[model samples]
Target: MKEGNDDEIWELRLYVAGQTPKSVQAFANLKKICEEYLAGKYRIEVVDLLDNPQLAQGDQILAVPTLVRKLPPPLKKIIGDLSNTERVLVGLDVRRV
Candidate 1:
């Protein structure tokens, strides 16, 4: 099962406000990371908090532009504008230490 875990697909949810500069940059950075590393093995669900603020509670989101890693166990949360791609990637367990 150890081998299976490494190859498992990733599920990521990015919470953001609509059309904000930070949100746009976050998406761009996330997209690049997914393509460069996770590739087709990941899914990013961008949530607009402006529309549904309630969704934040499920993940205990305290801030906008938070990225939550929901799958593959040991769920992790990263808060910010996703200004740091490498940091976010590592925090999400998409890249090893």
Candidate 2:
């Protein structure tokens, strides 16, 4: 699932507060998307806001389940349970063939 010959890596951060239903769903959805689209070219870091609330400020997280694309420049964010694959792909600027 590498985008091109550049060998670029997709750095994603999932911010959640404890193991709520939404948080769990978001993580599951994200993993599915990455496995299908990103494969080995992606890295997911799950950050529990409940454990470290101060980290939220750096990312400006305002919700329970927020997906942050930290690498590849022009950082992007998608906030939700991430049940919509098409929307998630669009939000991450990923075009499926």
Candidate 3:
């Protein structure tokens, strides 16, 4: 894994409808990826759409368990449980294709 600058923090937002199996898995997978690759340079914000449905509009989210890379610029979205590490890394711009 490449080391990120300590001055730059990664902001990640995860949108989920509820504590569904997929949502839970997504969080787990994302956490693992962040811990392994980003380590101390990442922040994860979990937004439950079931609690605040309107929040989805901000990111134009249409699916549950969607991950939005809010920081590091060029915002990105990935929809799924995030079990695929390689795809998530590429989607988050943590790795080049």
Q: TM-score winner among the candidates? A: 3
Please give the lDDT score at residue 3 for candidate 2.
Answer: 53
lDDT of 3: 0.93
lDDT-wise, the better of 2 and 3 is 3
lDDT of 3 at 46: 99
For candidate 1, report its TM-score.
0.87
lDDT of 3 by residue, 16-78 (tens): 988999999999999999999998899999999999999999999999899999998989999
Q: Residues 1-97, candidate 2, lDDT per residue (tens digit)?
A: 4354347799999999999999999999999999998888899999999999999999999998999999867799999999999899888877644
Q: Evaluate residue 13 in candidate 3 and report its C-alpha lDDT on the 0 to 100 scale.
A: 98
- The list of candidate 1 runs beyond 4 A from truth reads 1-6
For every candidate, C-alpha RMSD to the true structure in Å? 3.1, 2.0, 1.1
Q: What C-alpha lDDT values do all the predictions have? A: 0.81, 0.90, 0.93
TM-score winner between 1 and 3, please give it: 3
> What are the TM-scores, per candidate, against the unseen true structure?
0.87, 0.92, 0.95
CA lDDT, candidate 2, residue 22:
97
Off by over 4 Å in 3: 3-6
